[model samples]
Target: MLNGPLLVTERLILRPPAAEDFDAFAAMCTEEETMRFIGGACSRSAAWRQWCTLAGAWHIRGFSMFSVIERSTGEWVGRLGPWEPDGWPAPEVGYGVRASFAGKGYAFEGAVAACDFAIEFLKWPQLMHCIDPANTRSQALAKRLGAANAGATRLPPPFETAPVDAWTQSADQWRQKRKEF
Candidate 1:
């Protein structure tokens, strides 16, 4: 029901969530390492609800995390894109890739595209990535994306107890940084 823009990179395709993406989405949500900083592994039913929440954002908010697909194999790699649910600290370009695809730069590629979409199309003035303190990999990714640690912030309920650092850069800063890519 959601028809949004399709972003294609050299190795991946980023698009709105589709029904066929559920199995992979659920699998990613259930992986302990994958979900460790993302509120821990969840049951398939919980994953379904989360997937629905992501999908529903497209309809309700006109934007959400995009389902990432491997271009060559057409496999679901993960989800990455603009996300800002109610009570969010700021507009964010978040990312998560399947464990099997870790360290492959797919997350970076997809995130770059997502940042462009968020800043250019969504017209957000700033972008932020809320990362747990222990998530060094993500912190490094944020640095690679030209975002700087702006300090800490508590998330909305359910995750309010979790500690996270905010990494941010304004649209103008992103535009300047993007030219280096």
Candidate 2:
């Protein structure tokens, strides 16, 4: 198992998903608002499959999405980490916040931390954030993390449901850019 200390940020805690988190996760996955850009609400079984995939990533790839928690309530606020869609060029740092948490800086904080981990620990050469063109919130977050717009592309095979614009940043680029934040 790829174990490490809980990833902590000023207002968030990024930790492995626990079995008990299924409820919160499932709720988020099923919420219309939360799944708006995720191809609509997923079934409970689909949510479980997603959880298993994240766990598999920890064992197979050494890093996976963390259940984002708010420090104040220790609530499962959303998810943040890297994921490799069926045939993508690289693992992309992805995030999804609950509807209630959407306007907060949690997305920015969690994503930047994940990017830093990939740069400082994983030694990944580059990181990407794929978002639908209509999701200005995520696009802005990518820019905040120093990812430059790479234009629209398919979401790799299997996971391909809609076209998306890709935002990319190299480890070297992130290092330089984070300092400016």
Considering every candidate listed, which one attains the maximal lDDT? Answer: 1
Q: What is the C-alpha lDDT of each candidate?
A: 0.94, 0.83
Model 2, 20-138: lDDT tens digits are 77888888998997787765689999999988888777777778888899999989999888777558756789899898898888889898888888778888899998788888878
Query: Using alpha carbons, what is the TM-score of model 1?
Result: 0.98
lDDT of 1 at 18: 96
Weakest lDDT window of 10 consecutive positions for candidate 2:
1-10
Per-residue lDDT value at 74 in model 2: 83
lDDT of 2 at 39: 56
Write out the backbone clash pairs for model 1: none
| Stretches of model 1 off by over 4 angstroms after superposition | none
Writing each residue's lDDT as its tens digit, candidate 1 over 1-181 gives 5478899999999999999999999999989998898778999999999999999999899999999999999999999899998998998899999999999999999999999999999999999999999999999999999999999988899899999999999999999999999
- Model 1 collision count: 0
